[model samples]
Target chain A: MNHFFEDSVFFGVTLSFLSYGLGVLLKKKLKLGILNPLLVSIVITVIVLVVTDMDYEIYYNGAKYISYLLTPATVCLAIPLYEQFEILKKNVAAILAGILSGVLTSLSCILAMVLIFNMNHKQYVSLLPKSITTAIGMGVSEELGGYVAITTAIIIITGVFGNVIGEFVLYIFRIKEPVAKGIALGTASHAIGTAKAMELGEIEGALASLSIILSGIITVGFAPVFAQIH
Target chain B: MKYLRQFGIILFISFLGEIANYAIPLPIPASIYGIIILFLCLELKILPLSSVKETGKFLIEIMPVMFIPAAAGVLNVWGIIKPSVIEYIAVMVISTIAVMAVSGLVTQLVIRLTGHSGHQ
Candidate 1:
């Protein structure tokens, strides 16, 4: 009876794309700002994995290729950064300042959470890279002796929120400029936020992409200092 | 052919990044090297933007597709993370909003002071 599904080799990869297709369909059909396809796909995939009694490791074996693609995707962001080089040259100072503020805010929040919640060493460290892109966040988290799986979960949770409410926050704050919007999205949400930024504007996409990298670098630096404190 | 060439440029840059990963003694990942080198390449005219712009855009546009598997992998560690689920969710939400508000406002203020706040 279960022979058909016993292989589970291609199932993971095939399911990922199929769920992504469903996510796209749902997003188009619902037209909700918060309807992130990645989030949707994960939810659906998780349910399917649970229902099918599939071990996550088996699923991961095939899905890891998609995960590997993140490296090149991170590399691809350079194109947008280059496209908006002029604005970058002009607003370098402001951009740096904004990144600093964002980095500080993220760190402080994590610090407070760790202190308040009394989280364990690994838990706190995993959450440290919660706001950056997955590839960099995974590296930083692992360097801090945290689990990559936990770090990714925290990161996606952060990104999903930022991708959804990021624009609403800007609208409320009256942050009309592309640079400001992009910085906030990228700094707070990483790649998913950058995707939202891309939808917002070219300038936003460029700045958000830049912000993703900068915040990542900042988190890498911050992780060491954070380790010393703990 | 155009897409292939553009993708080739990105892959080639990523390859260099792998080398820089060993050459440089930073915790920074190879992908970061890829980004930095590519930026320098585009800026220095060593690699023309027109060559890779479309392909780069396409890859980045669909980046969410790549993140799905990682996010789903959360299932593997959910048992360990389940205890602090509430705390984790709270921290993520609060921190995201705080970071966004602080950075966005600070950037807007700084750019405004520079007298160039026309959304650019």
Candidate 2:
């Protein structure tokens, strides 16, 4: 099976598209509240890699074409952000205050764990930006001599996990306000979590988008200072 | 003509961020430095909304794709990461829920205190 498709772009794109497509199909059919398309796709891809014993480098080589799309996708977020600026501006103070508090909470908890476990600085630094998005978190972690791979894993896990349970917890607490729900998830979990918040409602989606950026900015601002303290 | 100036401003800040990241002793990443510079620019009216809006919008749209590169790292850790998959999974699941609960409660409390009453 591996020899047949040793060098083919279709290999990567097909696996990616198929995994995500099937995941989305499962999500719709099963009505599984937390079955994220991205997560499921990733799992499927990993299983393929392991089963076929194919090299990850080869898979990435084929997928590199699609990877270029990331820049434009990031740029697309501006539309919603611009559209929702009115709400963001109106509640800027409260929202900022809440988001910052949540960020602080996540960082503090991670640092506390580091100390409790008696982990070394390498582990400590890797987890420093655990709550932020992967790109930024990986960068910060590498600069501080931490493991970027671990940090990236932590960031994605945090994002997918936050997204999966975020809405349910909101319902559990009887917190129905779209704006509040959006801000909470985005600030705590970043973009993927925000995407889930969007599914709940437009207002929630808007707020989540706004919060994701704001939280990223805040995390960017706080990471250095926080890292220094630890 | 105006758009040109906005583009220049963003590019300049991005450059400044890179420079500061290399030259300064601050323990922060450069792109983040750019974000800080941009944030200050927005606050000071040095970079108007109309100008930076397009560039900012561009970055936000494709934000998800950024994960692709990092997700690639999963490959590097394949051998090591697999051993503790279940442990990591538990942490991932539990911590995500914890974050949602705590952040949601805190946000709602703040909203209630602020008295917006917009929540429906």
User: Residue-pair clashes per candidate, as listed?
Assistant: 0, 16
Cα lDDT tens digits for candidate 1, A111-202: 88888989888888888889987778888888889878888888987887787788788988888878999999999999888888988888
Worst ten-residue run, lDDT, model 2 chain A? A70-79
| Predictions in order: lDDT | 0.84, 0.67
Question: What is the C-alpha lDDT profile of model 2 across A1-230, one tens digit per residue?
Answer: 66656678777867776777787899999988767777777778888887888888788767776665443343334445555556667666667766777777766766666665566677667777777765567777877788787778878778766766776778897776666788778877877776676667666766776666666667767767767766
DockQ of each: 0.74, 0.26
Q: Which stretches of candidate 1 lie over 4 Å from their true place?
A: A1-10, B118-120
Q: Going through the candidates in order, what is chain B's TM-score?
A: 0.93, 0.79
- The number of the candidate with the highest lDDT is 1
The 10-residue segment with the lowest total lDDT in model 1 chain A: A1-10
Q: So what's the TM-score on candidate 2?
A: 0.77
